[model samples]
Target: MEGCKRLEQLPKSIGSLSCLTNLNLSHCDRLANLQIHILEQPSPLESGLQRRKIIVHLPGEINKLSSLVNLSIDGRIHIQLLNLIGDAEHISCIPKQQTPDELLLSRCYVLKSLNIKRTRYNKDGSSFSCISFSDFHSLTELKLINLNILTIPDDIGQLQSLEKLDLSGNDFKSLPTSMTNLSRLKYARLSNCIKLVALPELTQLQTLKLSGCSNLRSLLNLSHAFHERVRYGLLELGLDNCRNFKSLSYQVRQLTSLIHLDLSRHDFEEIPESIRELSSLGTLCLNNCKKIKSVKDLPESLKHLYAHGCDSLENVSLSSNHSIEKLDLSHCFGMKQDEHLITQILNDGFSQVVCFLNNYSLVN
Candidate 1:
């Protein structure tokens, strides 16, 4: 019930209460195991189809909830419940220690939402097949964090109802072409997937994040027709740390509805003139882009600009229509303390501009 910290196991007879629907066993830090089984076979006189349904909260015993509809587990413990019966509406598992095979989740047909974080395999350099979710046609949100997974299964396109998918902090080198068919997908995060070389075409995607994917060399061959379909719904795009990309301003200008753009830590030498076309751009972060020499042609819709650590930038030319509220230029070694630049920035009516000069003064 409450604060059962030392609880190590559940009583087998606990299943006798066939009508029990809610169970809260959270914060039982010392709990390590649990066993479950059906109790008291249903009699013919029972009114409804006699089935077990429950909600459980434990550290590493989720496998015991074979009839669970909602389950939450703690730490980074792997789970294996492929043949589970009930249709779980929500399931959260923070894997502690185990391989992908140990996570045997192949047959959860009615599962709707699955979240996993910090799941690592038992040994380094070990590979595993992607968990198939074709049976979970009702799934909506899926998250996988720090899994160290090398590849995503090609069959993932089958989940037509999936709305959000996050695959951050993995080792995937590429995605299957089937990803383009996810028409209902709205939000996607692929941050820190350093080895990811390319992306599958995302036609109906609204939010796309590729932050810290250093090896990502190019955007897939997305044409103008594809851009038009995503313009209104696409809101955020992150290409931070994609150093190999030669030019993105031309490609990015197509997303007229883009609100946030991050291109930090790259090899770009100049902000292209085409950047002024993003009339809806709100937030832009260009930190650590050392080759950039100046800031020019920024859109008036820009609200936040982060140019910190750009040691090669010599000047910043802000337009009179600038609406920037927050500007960060810390550690910009090449930018001299010019009174005109400060006066111009203030005259632009910005609320806050952090300029950490070498002289140790906050120029706002």
Candidate 2:
């Protein structure tokens, strides 16, 4: 009964419909109780409780829906009690927990995608044991963000059908080596995982984002995973604000197909000379890289270069026949002081370039 704004509850007798395959209770703002109805469900193939503002509890009786195939409970409402069951293909829930209990996920045998976001931290430091993910054979995408997860089981690699994984804002120090076995995994985002110290070789990934992982010290495994034959598959890599990661130069030379690279907030004094090897690189971000004094040895394929807020930048060398379409050196104090540097930049065969210098811009 969707759009039933005043519907307060489902009758307990309604559960007797053994063949009930679909139940949609969307936009039911006053409906608050489903404990009795859910506990008696003999068989339900689909159930949706969307936009129910007063429904905050999903009692353990939901596990009784043995034949349920698809379940979706969406809205801005926060769930106070969560119970997972059935052979559902897709599941999404936001639960307030001290420690996210992965053991509850063991029952989703045929699940395809799961996203669980923890809304609070555990003050008592109590948590359930991690369960093996090997049973989720049909699972393709999994996102468990900000759950204070220290690690995951090795059986995670057994998810042969998995493609995308996002564990951003978690507390993982490292990942299991078995993750490399996911041949079809294309995207992985670990942004803001401040405690993450390392990662396994996931060469099959086309996009890897690690924007705020400050403790990470090396990326040798990621680089070593690629060779001349397969390196061209990786298209995007983000390492912005990864302060201690210094193994960028040599490893980047291998990603011949990289189109976008973010090196913002790094302490490097110069752009890696090996960057010129990225023949497919189009966008390069060096914003707030204050230590870099000169810009040179750029890739000929670079279309956009962002070095804004680079206060120490003084000299910039661009080839006469280069393919650069835009260059941003805004807020570079050193460049504004050197009149010769400014004059040299204007005469560097940039007749068709759009350049941003200090507070002004030049579009020739």
Candidate topping TM-score: 1
Error of 2 at 248 (Å): 2.2
Work out the TM-score per prediction: 0.70, 0.68
- Model 1 misplacement above 4 A: 1-70, 83-108, 119-125, 222-232, 352-364
Q: lDDT for every model?
A: 0.67, 0.67
CA RMSD per model (angstroms): 12.8, 11.0
Tens-place lDDT per residue, model 1, 106-220, is: 3334445777555432224333335665545667887766667777877789888789999887788998889888889999999888888888768578789988887887664
**Which pairs of residues have clashing backbones in candidate 2?**
98-122
Query: Cα RMSD (Å) between model 2 and the true structure?
Result: 11.0
- Cα lDDT tens digits, model 2, 1-364, are 7666676667765444444544565455455454223222233235843322223333333322333333444222333322322221122622211113533453444556766554443423223224567545667888766555666778889988889998877676899999989998999999888888888867788999998899987665655545434343678889899998866787787677899999998888899888988888999999999898888888888888999999888878776556777888889887854455455556765676767877777766
